[model samples]
Target: MLAGIGLLAAVTVGLTGCAGSGGSAPAASGGISEAKAKTATSAADFGGMKGLVASANAEGHLNVITLPPTWANYAKIIAGFKKKYPKIAITSANPNGSSADEVAAAKSLKGQSTAPDVFDIGTAVLNQNLGLFAPYKVSNWADIPADFKDPAGKWYYDYTGLMSIGYDSSKVSTPPTSFADLLGPSYKGKVAIKGDPTQANEAASAVYLAALQSGGSADNIQPGIDFFSKLKKAGNFLSVLPTQATVNSGQTPVVLQWSYNNLAFGAAGGSAGNPNWKTVILPGSALGSYYNQAINVDAPHPAAARLWQEYIYTPEVQNLYLAAGAYPATLAAMQKNKTVNEATLKTVGEPPANFVQLTADQATKAGTLLSAKWRAAIAG
Candidate 1:
């Protein structure tokens, strides 16, 4: 999850490290020119879905970055796409990398056959690297809210989850109810943030949520930094980047992460090693954020990349995200049309109305502040 607009704002907004010049072939010697796919703004540009599918089938591959199988049910989503289009093979790299890593990978692999075709990134990173994305709208563009996508189609939100506190019940008799509860001695050396705030959107959102809880707003994140400083000083803030294995092993017993991720871990339960893992969204501390999806400007498999955008935006795929506990970008439309999965709706429910989200500007500013202050404030 990355910095995005709040629900009120229509609830808007990878790791690759390296730099490379993205280049394109002069023309396709065969069918469905790569140059044409690179410049296409919609399926209509390719003569419609049949033409687009044929072009993509000719390309035969899609390279993606920073998509972990376990996160937000990507495994099943990927499988579903494969089932739908067996001709297009999907290759995902650096599944655990941050948004920054995605940018780096784009640069490093530019013009190569293995270069990523699309990106799933945070709004903060998206704003900072706007030049890298190509402008292309999906078939269901109208279904997405105005605030959730760029008018030019450079990027659009894919799915979202609320910020939450996840803890191991057996390890801590008193589960944390709020950010203040984390400062007590019982939680010393137990709490962990997902990743480095300066580089990872999840960690940045965790800070953003803490800011709200500690007398700060979207534009003011210093309080959140100060709150973490206080936690560090009290020996309760652990600097480790947490993962599923860490949570299951009790290494990072208390973690600040997205609700969907925590819920997934809890669902894994004893079978995955941690029997008492639980997730909670603190009252009055609701914070929601969505990750944006974009096509790489110099994607190696241009047609395949565009096809991927078309495939994922379908209501069926959106419903897949819901089953994984993530609220899809087309959620409102799904609900209005009664296309959403009722069972999933009953389980996860809708996003909180009061949750606050940051606009692109707010996220960029907050990210800058974190880059400058986060490390020094929480340094051990």
Candidate 2:
């Protein structure tokens, strides 16, 4: 549940699922393996690659939701998945949808082909929808920290990024380096957050970072809310969510978002597709957190859903997450194996030494407060 935890992401079977033959196996009743599919909690549950691959390819596609290519270098991850498993077609929906939106999609799209087969969301949202996740443990399950994963293998923490300020160097003469700089007269009508704090994990993290800077702790978030309310009163806060288009057009000259988000936008955003944007650090506040990944419990393509999770934890893919400024969940294991990409580390550097991380209880408490107070605090 820490800030940068981008709660975010394969198999083969030798034979066609029972759905195809219906001889002795009816696709194992919602699973592609000869074993019951719905009861599969991990890749081991499947008999072998022959069944998993064939069953997954038989299902044909993976429906993932809310995976913006810019966030944590997901474009590469998706591309890699397809390359590794050429048969499974991967489809992404709602690139701009939030953690809350993902849970809603899983529940609301229960029996549909469109249900997100996999998810990358914050721990707060993950907690609300635990029962909806199909319990799954990756091949490298031992590599993940105990505290970061669910005991039942339902969901696990994936990566972490810090909250940061993204700026267009050409527009602002003096780029704000501190949280206080955002409230200055020059920033009026120029600064924006990724989304509404009550609904978006990134936006809510921004509020938490502001609280840290505004004489508050995880126990008290009012100060952060007050800081934004002040920005609203000064006309400095624009509700429009920051996007590559918005950033390039100067609509949102400054964006308060995750460091990975800011860096990704800077590297690939703009009219010419260049890294013209810059990310700045605020004094003494690194809102570091990890996001969670889960599989839809009732996913139509259960085999494909499980495959996606396995692929994401691989060393190469985990490194892809790092190249895009995210700290992958298997980082510690990678370091031990001497597979930690030093070059990638230099791009993002070590996270701030002075950082604030909310405990499970603190985050749960904070979520309640944010949901109840965010609207009134920003209203006219």
Candidate 3:
């Protein structure tokens, strides 16, 4: 849901603070020689990023999917990559697509020049498509949390956030403080969601938060589905893609989405004259999760892919993650290295002391349930 609308919907530019999809098989080792065609898990294994960078420069291109410039400040990330590696050109597709779409591209575009070299995926989708990914460990591997990465180093979390309510404080006299408050009369015809929960990971997380607040747990999300049903029946729910434009125009004044997205949307449109846009991760719904990053098994530009991974996990890139309001995976390492700026951390906020993190299995179950019941809930 961290989107810069239309930056690259058909072709454009684009967390982990939550759970995701995955498996463990350590990066090929134990006498696994570094063949020229082999995927490099680390720059050191590939003779270093300098060599990888040289090879990638020869290839001169990288294809990425589902990245928008505005999402996590990817505009800056992509621009940085291009400037840093002037020879390697980057083109993205399906900017508004989902984690499922990233997996889909890895499968659908195999052997094509346009195939994605890397992926940013959700926990469930990551687990479901582990076979499609190649194991990779960046130079900053030690900086990442053990729990946030694959035991074998196939994939790892980049950043994360919690589900929260974004509202134009000026439009709604009193904003909702919790899930139950969303159902009150003050919010009718005002609340909107990102997309159908069953299909989109962000939407699905919002639904999970609702379920948790409505007497459900990771294993059972029926309460969330039921809550939305009541929301629809009460005429408070609108199935709109909550973008910055929608918020600016006051068409969808209240949105349920990730805190980073909400905060970004509010910041984009809020001014001194109209400074009431706010984000609230209620006491009842502080779910923390993160998205994962991995290389495609059959990436068109393998060397470039490995180099990209190395660059992203670097300290400078990790700070960019914070600049865009994401808690980077290297947070602790950055702090320890005296590279982390405490003031910058404030912008992204701290991970909740009371947070609900879904496991890969729990996410799959919730996704299935949401798929089966979401459309009927809103009759959408």
Candidate 4:
């Protein structure tokens, strides 16, 4: 749940494309093959087949639009890409607004004159606007996990964050350990959530976590609603969404947030002396949601977009994200990235010892049921 500056910066920079393999075999999930990786690595020698980078530079520069304004690390990532393709210039335009704003921009890009070369969007937006993407499977596409990419190769997830609970130690001695703990008397009137289930990603995370805790499947979300209803009855649920400032100031003691956001807050204000904050990934819960990147269907600089994507998914960049408390999607990169210290991994809430990946269809169905159930629970 890292918020604002650090989280967005890490996500933006860390979300580069997958790396090319020299001789490594392709993963079953449709990642980059060894041969393609070598070709991409030697992109400068590709001659007339200059790929997206050449095309983008020919157009003067590559244009990118993103939703996360706090993505301060964009410059660093862009700099890295520039080192490889010096001729390609990157122009970034971040329209600060909701997912709806990104969707609007995607639609706007359909027009030849107004189109951007790349886009970064939330999971919901990516799935909803699959049409805006051009499905040119990257050379490293085989390396990416199937669950992380679109079936049609439209969009792919680079990093992920778990929806977790944050607690202010000054306000309470024992933080909630499990989902049931949130319903306890000590936490009554102390909890704050992000959004209504139907409106926000964080709200959807809450539902997903509740469903997991209650043993509900994608088709059954009653457990999630029941969990929320219990909290509502106890008058424990604070309906307002907690912000970075509010959490850092200790104004709201307990918040359901992304692990990255919580970690960022803790890094800023959490210490041994005051020890103001702490975050915990509730057991028996799924990773709440993800943010994704995609190349525009008619990108003016397709090669640049591909290169950018590759850079974002590399071990070095992924580690940068891990440093900021977000989880990288590439297992190889995660294993190779030395910057991802053990402490940071613990804070970011790595997958459980025995984790199960969810299918897109399953996630969609689960989200739908959970939304309905959450509404009923909140109402009741």
lDDT of 2 by residue, 1-380 (tens): 22222221000101111111111112533335433566688776776655666667667778888888767777777877877888677778888899999988888877777777788988777776678887888888999999878888998888888788888888888878677899999998999998877778888889999998889998898899999999999899998988878888899999988877776666443333324577766767678778888888787778877888888888898888877677888988898988888765654565556767776677778888999988898899
Model 3: residue 35 alpha-carbon error in angstroms: 8.1
Runs off by more than 4 Å, candidate 1: 1-31, 268-270
lDDT of 3 by residue, 295-349 (tens): 8888777777788888889888888777666678998899899898666665455
Candidate 4 residues 142-189, lDDT tens each? 667887887776788866666778788888788787888888898888
> Superposing every Cα of model 3 onto the true structure, what RMSD results?
7.3
- Clash number for each model: 14, 29, 24, 25
Off by over 4 Å in 3: 1-38, 268-276
The lDDT values for all models are 0.81, 0.76, 0.73, 0.58
Between prediction 1 and prediction 3, which has the larger lDDT?
A: 1
TM-score of 3: 0.86
Comparing candidate 2 with candidate 3, which one achieves the higher TM-score?
A: 2
Candidate 4: worst 10 consecutive residues by lDDT? 19-28
Q: Give the number of the best model, judged by TM-score.
A: 1
Decreasing lDDT order of the candidates = 1, 2, 3, 4
Candidate 4 lands at a TM-score of 0.70
